[model samples]
Target chain A: MEHRIESGADALYMDERDHVATALRDMKAGETVQYRNAEGLRAVTVVDDIPFGHKVAVVAVEEGADVRKYGEVIGRAVVSITVGQHVHVHNIEGIRGRGDLGSKEAAAQ
Target chain B: MMNGTFMGYQRANGDIGIRNHLLIIPTVICSNQVCNRIMQMVPGGVAIPHQHGCSQIGADKDRTFDVLAGTGKNPNVGAVIIISLGCEVVDPAALAEEIRKTGKPVEFFDIQSVGGSVKAISHGAELAKRMMADLEKQEKVPVPWNKLKVGVKCGGSDATSGLSSNPALGAAADSLIAEGGSIVIGETTEIIGAEHLLAERCVTPEVSNQLYHIVNRFEDEVQRMGADMRGGNPSPGNIAGGLSTIEEKSLGCISKCGKAPIQGVIEYAENIPDHGLYFMDSPGNDIECVSGMAAGGAHIVCFTTGRGTPTGAAVIPVIKITGNKMTFRNMEDNMDVDVSDMLDGTGSLEQAGDRIWQEIKEVAEGKWTKAEVLGHQEFSINRIGPSL
Candidate 1:
């Protein structure tokens, strides 16, 4: 959002949660660009690029703040995220999804 | 803008509507046939044959209740006559109460109350005639553009949809929003992977979260069905039209909402209270989805399609826009706006937006949408249940 580098015919889309994402890069184009994700301010570089319109784990989640991508709860970050970093299931985990038949039962317990 | 007009009925609830319709609402499936027969006897009434109203429980039951209430409350309806079987799980009185709150005259007759079908049909027609007569005396005031709440939707999508028709409609949506009008967008399942793009534009964190929740809810439901959404969410039709994945399909689907601040999310059939850009949690089922938006109070719907559709709401004017040259050419009779020039590179997005905006004014002023002129009174409310 700060600066636009060159995507080279590649389009970038924010995930459901607006963390730092590589959500939708052109898959077949091999055409890619880089951006500052929890790393350098005004950063522009390609790190974990994928196909056209593929998902990329986001970085830069703050404490207790939900990650935004794919317009849904992909996961919640356990710790803080810096700009220009990669966020995956490793740091972000389920908060609204069913790993246990939902936590309303756990809440009751 | 547009200086067009259509024959519409004015309602006491302070709503301007394009249709003066007597709707026969069946409280239960057992009464659907009776309702249909009543519609057959009446010249200007409409009937919805639904699978709900009985044999549903829990959220399924609640969904049916919402839809029933929503349908009866659509502003296009001048009057409503509920056809009931007397003892259904969803109460006809409660449904009638919801509709009556809109200040329209409503009458209900149970087939059991009249000893069967023939008597119910006879009674329903008579009530419809009286209601229609009362509605005829109403008049239309020059309602502002802001008073219009139109639903934005796309179906039978193609790649050109994202590049042309969808963005054009989105521009029109932005124009409408700028004019203080309301725009509602649905098809939650179609927006699976693209929810974040919309979330970033949310007016508030709460609205952002609602956008997140629906996408998550849809993903969970698809998972529960044990079939990958990648299978059907994009549909073979969509794939043939060039959308590659559910994510890709969704990326294009969200464009219809335009660049407006997200206000909030509403339940599938919940009333669209003073709309800005409202997202309704609904499936991509064309008939049911359009039905849901209609019931929720969209006076009109601007549906963009790349593959083409003949679907129309029973009451509201459904204006169809397409960017596919072949589809537009082949299905010329069904389409309202052929924005294929955008694909041909002969038309710019702003030009298409102006044209559609002009069409909107014309439609609002009472120009019959192609669907209306073709008598495409297609009506289907999402039936969230199994048959007994």
Candidate 2:
């Protein structure tokens, strides 16, 4: 599987199924960025400045829904995430195989 | 079979070593000072001084013995000089006997038997100097890539780790495995959130069970210690480097193993089996993981770091890779390969992998890694149980 962007795309979607695309370079607010996925090439307008190597949600994710990257569920979004928004620790929670998530789950409820 | 070969020292047991080193081992923490002194006195001598060896019980004591013996037994080590504190739980004679199985020269002495610290250092240094001279005269012979066993590891990870360097390293690992070589991936703690992915790749049901067993066992130990792995993992540096979750970090961590079927699961510091890929139950801590791989008989280790680390081993060489352009530029002295081009769209992952594969060959041909050139011989053995 190839992972390089020959078309000068500013972001990368690891798989067509991945809901989040990682920023290959920093993008200013309102900048339109191109990303390639399994489906085809697509564009998203950055609502927030995305730094290098950080994830930007390519698809809108509802609160408590899984945030998929590399075609796998990395975590669940803590708040409703819109497309082009910066996705990081502030808005997502790690829930996979955790032993101490009861308090976090309770807080979410 | 893999094409091309590098100049190496082929051992009597048929294992090929990239380097011929004189190893000095301390059976107890009490012997660490004397071992270090002896190593210093002898040119080209390396010593691994650890803090365990007395009042250790059961598995802990066995682990120490295994690591020390394994280090002495590594193919890179041409000869060994063992130093004991005269009275420690780890038996130097038995340890030397274990290493002698490889048919390498081994010598042992305890402070009590040798009179005192002064006499012990003098005796150990003399033995080490001779061993070093003997190893210096050993000629390098052509050894195929298939004879190589490399441990794949990542530390100080960030988002680019999974996206670039780790996956590029994975490609390189696959290339080696395709040629009948063996690749080892460890760090059970780092694979916490995404172990199921690896478990699914096991070649057999038994191997899958062992994979799950070790992951579960580590989680159980963490729970017993009244701590959760997610709290400390992904580490602070990882988070600062833009990793938000343990799941995110782990998903990236496993990429360094390439896309190989998990052949078997081995205990920490156990001898790595020949051929294909094996998973060792080891910590994600950089030095401890590298040490386990070296003790497991790895000829070389490929280490990926996003934030940068200058860790090397006492015996084998550690090739450092980074996927962060900034980290690479900032820590140019510490890093070797820069796959950051994958992130910048200047290079493909395959090309980056090929770059690393070339580095491995050159290193096997006697090229020094940045850590080796900088003389960073960091070594640490993973310890279990308490010291009494």
Candidate 3:
């Protein structure tokens, strides 16, 4: 569980299992940033200008797929998402405490 | 750091208090004005005025009585003055008797019995002045750090809250527990999505079951009202601050409890047992949560907020912590410590935790927090049922 701090690192990898990384600073579109996860050092280009404290998709997610942050399911994708895309309420839907757990049930489809 | 002690007022009941306050409490809402007037007339008198003393039945009325008694029993309060309207559901004499068990001075008066508001105010003020003077005479002695009970709370949370401040607070919580002190983390609403994580840490299966039961009961209450808990939580401010769901907010919220095995689960405003970490079933509202902790005998409170809030309890000092650098700078007057450096990699989590631990000792040693210095004595009781 080592996270290498490469040059120009702009986001924090909270946990190795987390599929989403948090932007430590406001990142510009197309900017490259280094992140260290359990798999070792890697880089992802920012497709959107992610605001500070916001999440970025470090792994591509399909529509209705669960989104993992802090190694727990924070929500599920409402539509297909790609790596480097900003992940938020616009493209993601919360699964926890949902009145219907519809997304969890929908994930099986 | 683990073996340190702080100067405190050691009460006859064997409880240690960090602050020696003369508390003026109103048994019913109808007596709020009289209590406030008494407080204004007497210097060094603190009053907690709230609604819901009349027309409350069942558990709701019991909660009001419990909170009032528990607050007066808080070790920080050196004495208590009770004001009643003489016809409220909560009897002033009964309330005074409950708090008297703590061996602290207790006095009571009724507006109706006293003849009118002016007479009641005058009578209450004179009693408060005498009590304040008497409390000031109490001497402070050295008390072990482990004897201290502190409440951990987070309000107006943001993305940075869980990431930096809350974990830092958790570390401090662990430190306190390791030294044999007690730390109680509350806000059942905030733990909606994170209950499983806490349940996994309970010392016994029964404790875990209690944890789940409280969370489920709260959810059921929300459902009974024909509303969704998610819609009200992660409030608009939380969303703007980058919290998208209750799970996300909860993941951050639970970090403040640290890694201690939960010793037990207690009802809101219940007496907080000494030692270890406990969970109090309470609301997410800042004032109400802090109020319950105070009533539960918390000598001090460590409140972490990312968006910043100026909330302090009537009987205890609240030390505010924030992880958002922007918020810390903008609300410097309200914030006590800033761990924003952890976000930019300028500081480590352990350092942030140590910083909070240091602030706790300083406050316990009679140092005033930003809220205390600003005179933010906010107090509000959480209600369970509607008024009849």
Using lDDT as the measure, the top candidate is 2
lDDT of 2 at A26: 85
Instruction: Write model 2 residue lDDT over B75-116, tens digit each, in one string.
Output: 999999999987899998899999999999999989988988
Would you list the rank order by DockQ, best first?
2, 3, 1
Better of 1 and 2 by lDDT: 2
lDDT of 3 at B8: 90
lDDT of 2 at B166: 95
TM-score of each: 0.77, 0.95, 0.95
* Per-candidate count of clashing residue pairs (backbone under 3 Å): 33, 1, 0
What is the C-alpha interface RMSD of model 1?
8.7
* Candidate 1 C-alpha lDDT tens digits along B50-95: 8778777878887887887787788878888888898888888888
Off by over 4 Å in 3: A1-8, A39-41, A100-109, B1-4
Best of the two (2, 3) by lDDT: 2
Reference interface contacts recovered per candidate? 0.00, 0.41, 0.28
Better of 2 and 3 by DockQ: 2
Off by over 4 Å in 2: A1-3, A102-109, B2-4
- What tens-digit string does per-residue lDDT give for candidate 3 at B1-388? 5546678989989998988888999999899999988888887788999986899999999999999999999999999999989998998899999999999999998889899999998888788888888888888998888889999999999889988999999998998898899999999988977899999999999999999999988766654555434557878788777787777888889999799999899999999999999999999889999999999999999999988898888989999999999999999999999998877777888889989998998898899999888888998889988878
Question: Which window of 10 residues has the lowest lDDT sum in candidate 1 chain B?
Answer: B1-10
Better of 1 and 3 by DockQ: 3
